[model samples]
Target: MSDSQRFPVAAHALAYMAHKGAFSPAQAAPSALLAASVPTNPVVVRRVTALLAKAGLIATRPGATGGSWLLRQPEDIRLDEVLKAVNGCAHIGSPPAGAKGCPISEHIPRQVGKALTAADEAATEALSKITIADLLDENPVSLAAYTPHASCPVAA
Candidate 1:
């Protein structure tokens, strides 16, 4: 699998919120809660949370009773947005720079590069159609449900 195929923490965190029915237009999770679900430290969750928060996908609160929550309906949040927020790169594979004067990469065709770019565009378009609500409806199984660990992987 490509590096892009690896699950992004933002997606995981959102899915967790969805499964728990924690997605409220005004509600938000505390850094600790997000970290626990993602099975990572608060710092990592904070990073991802900040990204989502910036995208207008989630809202955060300060002081006691403060936590993060979905800022919009789950149906309004696109998978592609989440992917972009966390990964910060095109979903399609990134090609390595070719050696200078390499005939195959340079002279052979521009079509290959165009095709890759097109594929990435198509993928993002398709991903944009999927929303967090779709995932919630599917009853996505949580990693903690099957794992024996007392806390989430991140918390450990």
Candidate 2:
């Protein structure tokens, strides 16, 4: 995976939380633990966790006893929401910025922007239909009764 694939990384981080946090008494998982699952640095995990927290998809607590956990149920949190929260993948490439003095530049940018915007919107719509619960490889869960499942283990 590319370093810029924030959507996958963030999705992995969230899925890890969904899997492991379910077993924690606080329903929270540490960033280091989350990073291990992402096979990424703790800083990256913290960055995405902050985004999730700001979007109200997840909650974060500070200090030694604090960590991150899902704020919304898996069934309620859509992939598009998480992508938007992380600014991950929704942008369908930057609009053309080549040859500003050329006649083609003006028309090319306008047309490409329109096309890309439409595509981005459509992709976001498709992503919205998939909730975190849908992404779960295991049966749906209620937070109150959540527990880590062996079959649904998230790989690094």
RMSD of each: 6.9, 7.1
Task: State the lDDT of candidate 2 residue by residue for 1-156, as single tens digits.
Answer: 343566777788778777775434286788888888778888788888888888888888877777888876777788889889887665657775868679988678889888888988997887787777766655533223455457666556
Residue 108 local lDDT, model 1: 38
- In TM-score terms, candidate 1 sits at 0.68
Give the clashing residue pairs of candidate 2, or none.
Answer: none
| 9-117: candidate 1 lDDT, tens digit per residue | 7787777776666666355567788778666787677677777887787776665677678767677788888877765545455456566788876643566667788
Clashing pairs in 1: 27-69, 28-67, 28-68, 28-69, 29-67, 29-68, 39-153, 39-154, 40-154
- The lDDT leader among the candidates is 2
The weakest ten consecutive residues by lDDT in model 2 span: 139-148
**Candidate 1 — worst ten consecutive residues by lDDT sum?**
140-149
Winning candidate number (TM-score): 2
